[model samples]
Target: MRLRGRKGIREDLEQQQDLVVLNPEAYKGKWRERFNNDYPIHVEFGMGKGRFISQMSVKNQQVNYIGFDMYDELVRRAAEKTRIAWNEAELGDPTTIQLALANIENIEDIFAPGEIERVYLNFSDPWPKKKHGRRRLTHPRFLEKYCRLLNTQGQIHFKTDSETLFEFSINSFADYGLQMTNISLNLHRDGINEEHVMTEYESKFMGKGMRIHRCEVLVGQDALQEYQKSRLDKY
Candidate 1:
């Protein structure tokens, strides 16, 4: 399903002139100076509709946020929100957010080594077909790319309603030697954990009485090596 834009979303981004890089190669090894901040970096992949990333940026202004999504329309909306947040942040306003239009699979080309501090995979496509399992966002192939860009202490946060996908991701993390922390099979049953922020999808699902599955995976060089070695034939 496609989403339509409200008035001013596109125009807002144009007015702000925020740096929204579409080409992955253009950002290779150059993101640090772009935002003019050396603070820790966090990313949200498939930032559908921009709600989660924008809200997180407002909550944590110290961490620079770079959201990646392939959909041009969605990216534009996200860029608008980021620009708004950035402006507010500059004017002593809270929340600083940035965005990029790129695929998660090209993450290594999108950010340099040791550049990323954290990653959030919020309600990604489950890719239910067995034959298409490799395309799953949490598949080992993509995890390898994440590992390459994330710093040694970087961590990945994932939330989804698809039980199968969550199980698959859990196994992938274990296979790659990533330590899993704070896993919740039913996030809402116990109330939203303070650390568990709601994405657009997460909020919608919870409203419909569906439970959210969440987990965190620590990323490091060793995990990256194992992920790459295991996914060689698949990728």
Candidate 2:
């Protein structure tokens, strides 16, 4: 799916404000206002093409979903997929879902502390080299950022196909003292596909007979309290 983008894709995407958010930072702490609802907000980092988040948003109208990516091309694809999904279901308004073009490195700048209810990392870049460990999305620094944005009962779900990356993430989460649950070494084999949403990359790996590893880490009250103490906390 990584190829040259179609011409004028950025312009087309920008015009779809209902699907692709603009100046996301402006609505940082007021995400619920942007959605025009009080529903909890959940986000997916590195949301390649929109399969998971779009479907989740359509299925779970009670929660607001946001997908973020650095590439304008990918964001365009995500918005198109969301529009198609909404249209297929005879839905006119897409107030529950939004796709944004932004890098996760400065995620904290886009959302205020305690504004997010859930954080999802699906098939994220492994950054395999030891020297690049900090660059991984599950790194402590990034985890801290997630914690800051997550509520006391916030959750972080991670999925990956690389055993090396999975192992690294397990250790990283443990070192951060985060509590993990419902871990799946082989998600599809565990008969849990019904509860999971497969991304485009995940489907490709599955088609190749690759196993997907998944885990969930909860941000305990203590962690959230600590984050709040250090931040200009927002709801």
Candidate 3:
């Protein structure tokens, strides 16, 4: 859910070079250098207003987090959230969090192969139209990109309120031959724990009595080879 543009959003985002990255592609494989440490890196795709990634960054101070969103307006809001968290922050160097603006289509271009440790897909756009299946984040095409971007131990954590999309993704991952584990049909049934961080969409859905589905897909070199050998474009 993208927000309507507010006045001065672009200017404010431009001024947030410390916390927001507009030219993210330039960093590419050099993200570790940007963070100035060897901490493992995790990224949240489509981070709406940055609730999940911001909290995760502070909670897991040992890991670096990058939140990517297509909207400058949302990026600005996420940066604002990070700033507030920085003030009240006790554990981590809030600098460990960097929000960026990027589209999912060219995501492979923004990072070099074997650069990311984990990728989070939280409440991503469903792109439910049959013709737009390629646009779904869980599509085999994007999964291929993530496979190249992640190290051998890299994994993707995904959550959604759309059962249709969730089932589609399950089939997609299975057909792609990528190993999936920790599948959850109703994630909050046990209630969110210290390790669980809710996104803006997830919080709203909870208020409306909606169920959240989640799953984890592991990335491996062997799986990458298998995915490259076959095609599931029909998905």
Provide the lDDT at 44 for model 2: 98
lDDT of 3 by residue, 78-181 (tens): 98888777677754446788999999778777899988889999999898899999989999999888888998758899999999999999999999888787
Error of 1 at 101 (Å): 1.0
Candidate order by TM-score, highest to lowest?
2, 3, 1
Superposed model 2: Cα runs more than 4 Å off: 190-192, 222-235
Scanning candidate 2 in windows of ten residues, the lowest lDDT window is 226-235
Candidates 1 and 3, the one with greater lDDT: 3
Could you estimate the TM-score for every candidate?
0.82, 0.91, 0.90
Q: Rate the local accuracy (lDDT) of all candidates.
A: 0.78, 0.87, 0.87
How large is the C-alpha RMSD of every model relative to the true structure? 6.8, 5.9, 6.0
For model 1, what is the error of residue 163's alpha carbon versus the real structure, in angstroms, after optimal superposition? 0.3
Per-residue lDDT of model 1, residues 1-235, tens digit only: 4767567755544554454655656867776666777878888989987878987887776888877887767877776665576576664443346677777777777788888889999999999999999999999899888887888667899989999999999999999888877799998897877875577788889889998888878686555565566669687
Considering summed lDDT, which 10 consecutive residues are worst modelled in model 3?
A: 222-231
- Native-referenced Cα lDDT, model 2: 0.87
**Residue pairs that clash (backbone atoms under 3 angstroms), model 3:** none
